[model samples]
Structures are given as C-alpha cells and as structure tokens.
Target: MGQTIIEKILSSHSGQEARAGDIVVAELDYVMGQDGTAPLAIRAFADLGGKDVFDRERVAFVIDHSAPSPNEGVSALHKLMREFSREKGFKLYDIGEGVCHQLLPESGEVGPGSLVIGADSHTCTYGALNAFSTGVGSTDLAGGLISGKMWFKVPGTIKFVCNGVLPPGVYSKDLILYLIGRVTADGATYMAVEFTGEAIGALSQEARFTISNMAIEMGAKAGLMEADDKTFAWLRRFTSRKFTPVTADPDAVYTRVLECDAAKLEPQVARPHRVDNVVPVSGAAGKPVQQAVIGTCTNGRLEDLRIAAGILGGRKIHRDVRLIVAPSSRRVFLDAMAEGIIQTLVEAGAVMVTPGCGPCVGTHNGVPSDGETVISTANRNFKGRMGNSNAEIYLASPATVAASAVTGKITDPREFI
Candidate 1:
C-alpha cells in the first residue's frame, strides 16, 4: 500500500507511517498570521500562557490585507502586530511588501515537504511547492505557535491529471475555474487535490501557484503539484536551500481521479456570487462592465501582469471601465516596472496601485459602487466580497480582464490573443 503525497509528508513530519482519516501530531516548519488574524492569534497565544514562541525564527507576521492602514483602527491592528513581533522576536513583513501568500514564497520561508500553517485560508497557496500547507483559525495557529506542532486528520487525495497542450489564450486560472465549476465549489471539501500529468509539469511555478491558490474555493484542505525540475529551478532563483522533492508513490490511492484535457479548455468566467457559477466566456460576453481588476494573489504574479500588458499594450481601456492593476509583491512590482509592464498598463489607462492586495478584499482600493458590474482576476465573487453587496463581481483570467477592460464587457481573451 503506497502512500499519497499528503500521507507521506504527514508521516515524515510525525515520524511514523500514516494514512487518511488518522489524526496525527506533526511538527510544523512554519507558522504565519496576517493583520486580519494575527491579533487574534496573539491574544490566543497569550491566553495559553505562552510567554514565548517555540521557535521565533519559524514564525512570521504580515500586514497585508488593508495594508497602508485603511483606517486608524487598522493602523492600531498594525501597531499591535508590530509590538507583538518585537516582543516575540519573530519576523514581520510590513506594508507595501505584498500579500502574505506571495511574500512567504518570495522570502524563501516555504519549501518542498515542509508543513506550514497560516491564519489565512489562502495559506494553501504554498502547496504549489509540494509543501503540506493549510489554513487554520487563530486558535489553532496560537497552539502551533506555542508548541511548534499541530494536529491534522490526514485527508484523502484527489488526483487531477491534466494532459494535452493548453490552447492559445487559455491559462491555469481558466483551468482551475473550470475544475471548480465542475467540482461545484465545495465538492472537494476537506480533501487534498494533487495536480499531475504533462500539463501540470509544463506549467511555470507562478501558474502552478495560481492553481493551488484557488484550491480553497473548492473547499480543499490543500492543493499541490508534485515538485519537479521546474520547481527546483524556480526555488533556486529565490533561495539556495536544497529541498527533496516529494512525490506520490506510483500506486498511491486516491479518493477519485479526474482527467482534464487542457487543449480543449476555453476561457471561463465565474458569475456573480459563486465561484462555481462558472461558464464559458461566451456565455457572459457582451455584458457591460464598469470596473476591471487585473491583480490578486490568485493572478497577480509577474506572468499574469505580462499577459495583461501584452493584451492591453497600445490600447486604451474603455471609457466606461475603471481598470486597476496591483502587483502581488513588491518584487513582482519592481520586476514588472523594469520590464515596462507597469508603464504599458498605466499607458493603457489602468490605475496601478500598491503592491499589497489592492481591491481584492474590497478593503481599500478599487471598490465598486452599488449596482455596478466588475470583471476581476481576483478569486471569490460572493455577494459583498468587494465591500458592496449590491455590486456584481465576475471572476476571469488576467487576459480576459485585460481584454474586457478595453471593450468594457466580458470579452473572451482568445479574441485579443
């Protein structure tokens, strides 16, 4: 009986053989919290009588969501996080740095086969490196901070084998949106999803990050891709730390197997209020859009910005559409600027905001007005997700958003590409 990737990682951390449905206490390599959750975690840690973290170096706090202090209240929260990090001697990433998920990988805090837990649900984004990363509530994070160990009920793995070549203008976002639509958002609840096959292997590390970043939309515990040469190559660019890539055994059991024909996939869009309410872009084309965003942890990588810039180059956005662009990290922002991607977007009538999660959570930048329609590259389009319950939010790839920004409607990216 071979073990799945999750099983193997858990077993290695637990120092014993393990399987799905088994609760095991495993040592964690990293623990993190952001401004929205760190204060709660700090409070919980103090309540546990934890005078000090088990490993100060392994803990991190990032002030990202609503960064640059949306209000005095958020500023107070930032102050609290700063005070806590100072008191605990842990690492802290402050405003203008970027979203926690993107910054962590950029900082080389995430690696293959490590167990990482963060207070943000999107912490699962690190699974792109084959790490066993998951999101937890503040209480669980507090416990991990105090003891350096956490309990996990190992989850069954769902294998998604993506074969064939991706068609023109199609992206990992479109592929994941298609999967989420088929899986119906909560279909993979409490399970691990491991992407495999030639398409997965061929994806850039950033593209893999996009796919794994959205796995939470399907209610997955973790979304992972097997670490391979490309993974190592990407990691090398950031850190010289050697990581032993973790792979599923040849006969590892899966709850179920799904096959995706990447060549046949089309541009997809998630309609207002539900990620699973996805349809081909054609279904939503010609619908008016007053706003379009081309950035988020889900699609705000350098490649994503390049794709949007390529489509928007030399073309102005529609007069009716307000286009906002945010780079996922300061590093990505600088790289984009060096490559002229930012200037191209700005020249194309897009508003470039800070590197932090601009307009994604509706906290600070680019919030839509009542009854307006927005096409965005960000994940989640639930009612009130963008700080306005009356606004309609549609989710699409960066290229789709870029094309639509020019046309002021839901336009298929293929037409522009």
Candidate 2:
C-alpha cells in the first residue's frame, strides 16, 4: 500500500483500508483521562446513557492539570473523577508522578501502532512512541466510552525533510520552534507531519519526540518520524515484546512538503502566549527572567537533562529566580541519577521533582506568581497558561532555559559558553 505514516497507523487499528479524507471509526485500544477533561467526560458518558467504560483496565484516568486542584471548582472535579474511576474500576493515577502523556508511556499501557485517545489537547504526546494517538474533546470521549470507537477524518500527510549536521547550540527544540514559526500555527491544519531526511534519521527517539510533541503547536493533527534504529532502541528498553516496525511506503502521496536544515539553526524560543511567535535567543537576550523550568514532556529527555546539567554543573541558579527540573518518566529520573545529572542540577539549587506533569501544564509545583516572568522548556505560553492571570511565560529550549537560570536573565545560551 502506498500509504503515509498517518494512513499506516490508522489502517492498523481499523480492519479496513484508510486513506486521506476517508471517514473512520476505529476501536480505541486505550483511552486516557486527566483532571481537566476526565470529570466532564465521565459526566458526559453518564449523560449519554453509557453503562460502563469499554474496558476499565484499558482506561487511564489521571489527575494532571490543576494538580493540587487550585480551588473548590477544580478540586470538586477531582473528587468526582476519583469517585467515578474507583466506582467504575478504571485505572487511576492520583495526583502523583509525571504528566498524563508522560505517565501513560511510562506505565507501558501504549505501544507502537496502537490507537490511543485522550481528553487533553497535549494527548498527541503519545505519538512519540509511534502510536497513532490524538486528542479529543470531552463530549467525543463521552460517546467513545459507550461505542468503543470514534470518528476521525483521516488527514493527508506532509513530508518534512531535515538534513545536515546541527549547529553547536541548535537542538531539536529549536528546530521545531523554527519550523512552527515559519509554518505559523495554522500552516499544517488538518495534516500529519512525517519527518524524514538524514538529520531526522540521526536523531534519537527523544529528539524526534521533541519535534512531534510540538506538531500541534503548528496546527498539525499528528507529527511522525520514520521508525528507525533509534525508535527500536527506545522501544526495546520499554518493551520486551517483539512487534513489526511500521514505515511509510516509498511512494506515499503527501499533501504538502517542507524541509529543515539543522546546521543553519540556533537556539530559538516561542515568545509570549502563542507558539507560532518565535525568534532567536539573541532577540530575547538581556530580558528579565524571574523563573526558569528546564524540564517537561517537550524537553524532559535524557539529552535535554545533560545539556542543562552541563550548563548548570558549576553554577548556582540566580537567587532572584527559581529553576525547577522534573524528569519525564521514572526511567528518565533513574537514568539522570545514575549519570550524575541529577546531582549537578540539585547542587546548583534546582528543585528536582519526580516525573509528573507539574508546572508545565500550569498546575502545581511551579506555578508562577502573579506578574512573574518565567522562561520554560514546556510548550505553550498562552496568557494565564500558568496559574496566575498576570504570569508571562516564554518558551525556550533546555539550553536557553538552563543558561537563563544561571544568569538570572534571559540571555542566549551562546553567552554561557
């Protein structure tokens, strides 16, 4: 079949051929729920006359957003979800450990080629594991609970080629930020992005994920890369179960095409509330930074940690600001400790946290106070995205964030070296 990555993934879940623009109702292998959406989804499921979930063990209900449940409204929602999941027997990961997407993969509930649905917008994070995953609203999730399926209009694919060696400070995060800046948030609306070329082949699964994780920021439905040796290596560590590796056909038709050159890039950031608003680190240099978070699903991988540790190895964070580092998974947390990255960060006064979706999603652990200005590695810095309505978030790569943490200001990473 001359299919693209999106079609290949969807076709596996569905028993029939799936092409671009075709309507599909594939059975969900897994469904995910987090605090903000789970409550409404469960309520909708009850309102729609669904008896029980399709499968209790197959569903993951996590308390991610509003982690400590900021106020009574959010706390009540948390209470309602806990009661529902426990009563109905759905898997519940209470307010502990990793973000929803980070926790799902860590628990081994999802695998390559599996179809997963979630009630959160960042649900696309599962694509890092080569699963055909996407986000859905609470209402759609309510319907899927009873029917065990959901409708998706198969999207056409876009081929993105990345070539050449990367510049010293340029990382996958900068690459994606640059791409999103150029493509604009709506550039790939309704399309899947398939990363190719020699550079993508050279990247680790974590690096590839840094690209796909922000695909939605560019308005792409799913961002995918070829399942290569790196993908297999990551999978091997996570799963002993053997499975076939899926790849797009050579002649797969694409709706659009774009290419990226890593050698020409530098550390970039998405300023303010919109992800599409990107600029070089130099432009944001000398700007004041009251906080810096160096870890999140978007940049919480091992290499990301190494980069930050290297920068913070000998320096302490600015006394005027705060720096928080959270591992993406238990595995990642353990690896960092074994590699001494953890010590380097903690010695520098960084608040190392267990793997959880804290702070990044504007929940607990790292919420900025009102009028605070912070530089972070997480995606999205929308207005009030952090708890305080007056908080301002500037998204940057791990290197930039680490450097800014050390300098107490938004200085370019190149300044540190």
Instruction: Give the count of colliding residue pairs in each prediction.
Output: 0, 5
Q: Model 1: how far is 364 from its true place, Å?
A: 1.0
| Tens-digit per-residue lDDT, 13-61, candidate 1 | 9988989999999999999999889999989998988888989889999
Per-residue lDDT tens digits of candidate 2, residues 25-71? 78898888788788889879878998888887778788766665668
lDDT of 1: 0.92
lDDT of each: 0.92, 0.81
Clashes of 2: 5
Best by lDDT: 1
Candidate 1 residue pairs in clash (backbone atoms < 3 Å): none
**Per-candidate alpha-carbon RMSD to the true structure:** 0.8, 2.0
